[model samples]
Target: MATYLDTPGRVCRSLSEEDMELVHALQINGRASFREIADVLGISDQTAARRWARLRSAGKLRVLGLTDPIRLGNSVWLVRVRCTPDAASSLGKAMARRPDTTWVNLDSGGTEISCSVRTRSPGPEESPLLQKLPRTPQVVDLSAHCSLHVFFGHDLGPINKRGPLTAAQVAALTPPDTPDRATDATPPVPLDDSDRQLLDLLARDGRAATGDLAAATGLSPSTVRRRITELRSAGALYFDVEYHPDILQQSFRAALWLEIDPSRLAEAGSALAAHPEVAYATATTGTANLYASIDVATAQLFYRYLTESVATLPGLRHTATAPIQRTLKGPGPYLPTTA
Candidate 1:
């Protein structure tokens, strides 16, 4: 029997082991060289290059260097905007184009748009694009949830037990700890024009070569490299890879919104984070204090996990579940990735 990495949100249907191995390598170090990945996976550099080309051309994968909004002098907010059906498409697209939003999607049959935005200040008035909208008749309602803490995010990019890399192979690709990965949190630092350009390019493709970055930013290769290191150490740059859940045979997906006693927020977060089915979980401000995105093999499996697994957690007050209708934009820099 052979395995396949299903391409959801696209026409493709199957992916080979080599294809997944290539993805796994990039996930560990998005900017790794084809030759380095080839050496670790026991394939030729040419083979690794060919596999990457195939996956990327099919739109089954994307490797991006995403910056933490908090590290960029911004606050992260989860915003849900409800619009009339006639206005939803245009409104969703308009929201997606803004520089601050990520993971934008049309849920609840296209009448509701869910997205996370980065604001320069703490209040809703400080949101770069969303604040401009008036509560006109066309816009039915809007709610904003400020993300207070992130327990699991970019650090776990689609992790699964079925990953293609072996323990030894993964060990070979892991990079040594840098100051940026330290426990101490640092305040957001300002960026000049050149730094922004570099991040914009990396956001599109973190594996872009030095020469490519130099040309794009009009800086020498050495200068580009130096700036990248500095920004990284300052906790400004991190990389993540995106893939649809269907690829792993975990097709059922839903987002859980829960209200928990404030005193036990950490206990609830840590408990939820321990579940393999939980993809992304966080503590936020809004009607629900905790939000989680989870994927499972089927509805039965999801129900079992919820009743048997999630029900056991302490301080869990209320819960709500919304099936992700279609991902209009997956997580990444402000780019829109639609199904």
Candidate 2:
């Protein structure tokens, strides 16, 4: 459980080391049983459950189910919108409310908005970027970068690879990899109405009990379990954990866009992905072929990382950085509690 200071500001303290270990355990396997987690963490099951409840009630953490766009034959785009200074907040909130948008953020002194949009195949007239945004009067300019390849993010989120977990503990808690049934040569696994309903419920609470999921989806427990397994095995579903960044003592966040030599794109992307400061990295289309989300403890530390780590990347031709002022939406479903 977390503690709060009794100072004039009544500031909340950061999570304790044990609490972070519990968080890291869930990152390893979000659906793991409390008893299982306790066993690995060397704590009692009741204590583990109580700590999780406290953290969740405090809105410090969440577990969510996310889908893979490529596995589902969909596309993802990173859109940057330059709007009127006064309209930036409204436009950002509107975009955050859209089910298709995630990672909605306000940057560049509250005059620009950035978001990731997931879209199924749509005609030009139906495309949000191609048709809808251009018609908005308040939007001064817009650029949508189609993701060509993801070097990090999704199931390989920063916490999944780096956290409080020791090598032995991580290995003990890590679940076996689900088989990859989603291949380019194979057609995407089709989702039925039931599948959609299940996904919606899990998106809100990935660790929802099997019985609760069965009751909500109007299916037997066995059937619900089987379907979840099938979806995960097909690479169509995955669990992601979200927590307050302060737990990791990170206070600065920034978005980076870089234009790299085409021949060295993969090399540059991989190097950026491996850096501890980066939360997400991908190769995209447009003037800046590579984009990344960075997190650090301070602005000075960020500058150090930029000069020491990022500046040394191979074939880096041009670079642009925008400090993220606020995040309206995260990787999971939109929730007002999300920072």
Candidate 3:
């Protein structure tokens, strides 16, 4: 087992260099063949497969196929809720169990919860962020921001930058870049029931064998492969590798809400997105129009980032930091704990 100190004045173990390399390879391409990963890492294919199995069985990593909300004509809302001290845990758990919520986390000393909500349409009635969350008596305050433009954190994740893979190794594992469909004018391809079923299975395990998927979905292996290609080409689905941050020796995480001059919003957002510490950055609608999630090794490093990386942004007006105390859900569907 690997670990890292969540707070100062504590020490914890972490993944070995070889394991970290394996993780980085998957982050580049979650569905890469074991032989491909082995070739890049200079290890045997059997070793690569064994390592991945061990990691997966331990719940230390997951490869998930995620849908693009924007491509599906949906809106993503970043919601922050302030709750009474005693109610935060239960509230966080409840939010995590919702299908529309991701990145559900406890923050601001466990008094505030932050999560992202995806809605199929643009109305208060259709959005849990607007309709259901504010109704809770234990919730003291709630704010939701509509994401306008994402500067980064979709195609690639923070691990790609922080992991130990060399440039050549990363390039070896990375698939060739294709034109982004999210910005194109093409209407999204509609998904049939079979498509949905395949997606659901992939959401649980992106690298599931084609035969298994065929058996589960009653589609032939060739059909499963073809559908995956079509969905990926249409930009309706993509893959993400999830793991504990401790594997990378990054224990501290925080969300940033920043107010920037309107004229400089695009420039600042792009600039912040390029920073190594930032995992996600987007422009949104609210008092603080820019939002980012950052991970680092320690509080001192975080301070240095604030001063060296963020302080110099042009037209910076105000900034607020909410430390993430725990994450209840990530990029994939939330699975409730079984009794």
Q: Candidate 3, TM-score vs. the true structure?
A: 0.91
Global CA lDDT of candidate 2, please? 0.81
> In candidate 3, what are the lDDT values of residues 32-89, reduced to their tens digit?
8999999999999999999999988876677888788777777889999999999998
Model 1 TM-score is: 0.88
Q: What is candidate 2's lDDT per residue for 1-339, written digit by digit as tens?
A: 111111121223577888878888887778889999999999999999999999988867888887888888887889999999999989888888788888888899889999888878622334565468878999999888888788887766666566778899988987775555344565667999999999999988989999999999899999998998888878888877776544545667789999999999989999998998888998998989999998887999999998999899999999999998877778777776422
- Candidate 3 Cα errors over 4 Å, as ranges: 1-12, 177-181, 184-186, 336-339
The segments of candidate 1 whose C-alpha lies over 4 angstroms from its true place after superposition are 1-14, 160-162, 177-185, 244-248, 333-339
- Which scores greater on lDDT, model 1 or model 2? 2
- Find the 10 residues in a row with the least total lDDT in model 3: 1-10
lDDT of each: 0.74, 0.81, 0.82
Give the per-residue Cα lDDT of candidate 3 at 260.
98
If ranked by lDDT, best first, what sequence of candidates would result? Answer: 3, 2, 1
Candidates in order, TM-scores: namely 0.88, 0.92, 0.91
Q: What TM-score does candidate 2 get on C-alpha atoms?
A: 0.92
Cα lDDT of candidate 1 equals: 0.74
Worst lDDT window (10 residues) for model 1?
1-10
